[model samples]
Target: MQTRRTFAAGLASAACAAPFITAAVAQSATTIRVSTAAPPSDFLNRALERMKADLEAANVGIQFSVHPASTLFRQGTEVPALQRGNLEMCSMTTFEVAQQIPELGYFNRGYLFNDHAHLRRAFDGPIGEDYRKAVSSRMGIEILATHYLGTRQVSLRQKRNVKGPADLAGTKLRMPAGPEWLLLGRTLGVAPIPLGMPEVYLALKTGTIDGQENPLSIFSAAKLFEVSEQVVLTSHVVQPVFLAMAKPVWDKLNPDQKKAVETAAKAAATWGDTARLDDEKTIVETIKGRGLTVETPDLKLFREAADRAYTGADATKAWDLQGLKRVQSA
Candidate 1:
């Protein structure tokens, strides 16, 4: 009788433990590390938080560890890291990809986008798909969604009013160290001084560079106003930010996980786009209130100059002029 009782107790214990074991297995989480160059308070980081929340709430066993402000990988290194599978994901600008695939530089061409809506339409439609395929094929990274960076503008050390490209001639403007960026600055009649982000502030403060161009949000976030006295509303380039994943990491995801990631990416992009647009509306006022002279220059002259520079034979060799025209019309 005791032996039978013992066997019954053992069977009961096994049955009780089965549910716990199954539950533990089902709850196992997959952690993904995502990195961005933007700070935690930036819209991009907020979007990343939204993605994390949605992914975790879905109970799909996926989680995210976000590293902001280039903590995981430095600004320029993100691309190479993603290519080598050393990093899982990054929020990066399309210009980073253009460095490798020169044809992608079409997106960075000055004054190419008429407005934010035009830029979004191009990305959400066929043009974005074509670029995504090219990036995957050449760089081994998959673009998840398009996010807004902001419109590029020129900020100067003093209230040096620039009415046209002629006024900007010989002015040393700090730009990202790249052929495309240099070409853009040169086309605008500025002597482009290639500098990294970290060096910008010190360079500006000590008069190493007379001016720089970036979105107002970046200028505000980086506290560039402290050094800059005037902001020219050049709006030379309306560029889009990209959420991308290393192809190897993306390939490892199962169908359900892939769906979760895609859903989260789209949501994050929407959130980021809204935040950026809202911020742009009031950022100029905020900057001006901080004692900066904001001017809206004759953008027509700048646009004409950019068009002439980018349509030349050498420039067209790097970018598809016809494709660019199609995007503009689209």
Candidate 2:
């Protein structure tokens, strides 16, 4: 058993397996794809471009290919794709994924953050960390970071100003296909038609839907103002974006690589947030120049309705009344 022939046989076996181990290690350095539902010109899309540059400079052999407008996957497919290892990363609205994980919808709550600073603090604390862990455990994804995507504004086909809840009655509101949006529409007593983004403009033009809820960036980019010129500053909900990576992809990275990606993601989020705010200002002026009637409602009724909606069935596990109160307080 201790003969030279036996030792040589064992050596041959070990040598045969060496290439397989090396090949497995080499596969870890392969490309990773990231998807976004937004168009190429979107603020978050631009941020992804920056992230690509940073990753390049950092010499991350792991290539990152950014797919815009859901080329790789749709908004609803983000979590599932990442979980199933079909996609490596994604940037999406939390509410979009909240359909599967209800707790994520809290990030979309109306008037949840008074300003950008408050939002950053709340998200950088225990609440955001908890959310990330919950998703990692339940949804099988790693949330690298979260940021304000955009501020939602109301757009209508008619000239009726949305000054209060009464004005919204009987109006067909196009909301993203999500439970929270449906709840918001139900609370306001409007007929909510859950539809995709591309279908929104045509619906408004064809009278299929009376109006749609979106931020200034979306309305302007989609040229919804062409069909629905009336813009209301309901600021109904704050659009929050979460940048998530597949857990398997993340696990493959060395600690240093993970840190670099994390830093780059946070930087990208900051870039996106700043870009969105600047675009908001520009779009506001542009909408005014277009002679669109933008109204600032009393906001009291909308706030109350949103609070009640959150306290209703939608509140279960998504967020706590007290936690939201603490966030508001902060």
Candidate 3:
């Protein structure tokens, strides 16, 4: 009886080990890697950290992690990487994905939101839903959630007191590399130059450019205030960030894992978006405390300029314009 019991225990152990052996024989595996453009010190970084915790808290039987500062791909290469399945997932800017899906710019159209509440409503409601569908269908990528990186405003190098939109006319600015941004500059009669982000500080120092448009966190992270003594808040557009996963990796997730990821995505989006607002105010005050001048210029005129520039562009229709207008009014 004792000998038979020992044999039975051995048999049970062998049975449990069989699955691992088969799985090992079937395929090689890797951690589910998520990438982001922000350095580890930024709020986006913190949000990703929270996501990692939430996913780990799930106690799921899989490896999950994040790669920061484009370790997997360059800053703008995020969506293309998603298409090729070079990486598992990413949380990136809309402009980075614009080439693949023009509709990804939906959240950026016009002066879309009066405040954070309005912005959240638009994204959590019909406008955000439509935008997600368009990207999923047109871009061949999955949209987990969309978020705001804070409002775009002008940060200037020299102490030119900007009282209104007319101040931007003839100002040479370093715009992101794309036609839409060029059109935006031309609408205001500003000479727009496309320069890589790393080059902006030296460009400002050497007087290569007069100003730049970015959310306050970006300006602070890049230390733009060292050369740029003035910050003019125009709130021209809300910079949109998206969490996306490669279709292949997305397909491999079990139903429960998929639901957990989706839930974490929404939570991360909300955390990153709201935390950015707080960071923006803190950074602006810090810059001002260092003796820099900050002002909220003619926001109305700036909005009009953005509207005039975006009119008739193919990218404009990708956004549910009526829905956005309702949110704006709300």
lDDT of 2 by residue, 1-330 (tens): 569989999999999999998888668675778888776777877888888888878876667779887777866777778888888999856675566676456666777777667777877888777778878888778888786777777788888866777788988998877767787776565789988776777899999999888778867877788997688788776667788898888988988789889988899988889888888877888997888888888788888776676675634455555765667776
Tens digits of per-residue lDDT for model 3, 109-177: 546567667777766887667767767777667778876767777888887867666787888888877
TM-score order of candidates, best first?
A: 1, 2, 3
Q: How does each model score on TM-score?
A: 0.88, 0.84, 0.81
Residue 261, candidate 1: alpha-carbon lDDT: 94
Clashes of each: 0, 0, 0
Instruction: Give the Cα lDDT of each candidate.
Output: 0.86, 0.78, 0.74
Give the worst 10-residue stretch by lDDT in candidate 3.
101-110
Give the distance in Å from residue 9's predicted Cα in candidate 2 to where it truly belongs. 37
If both were scored by lDDT, which would come out higher, candidate 2 or candidate 3?
2
lDDT of 1 by residue, 58-107 (tens): 77777687888778887778888888878888986767888888877788
Give the TM-score comparing model 1 with the true structure, all chains together: 0.88
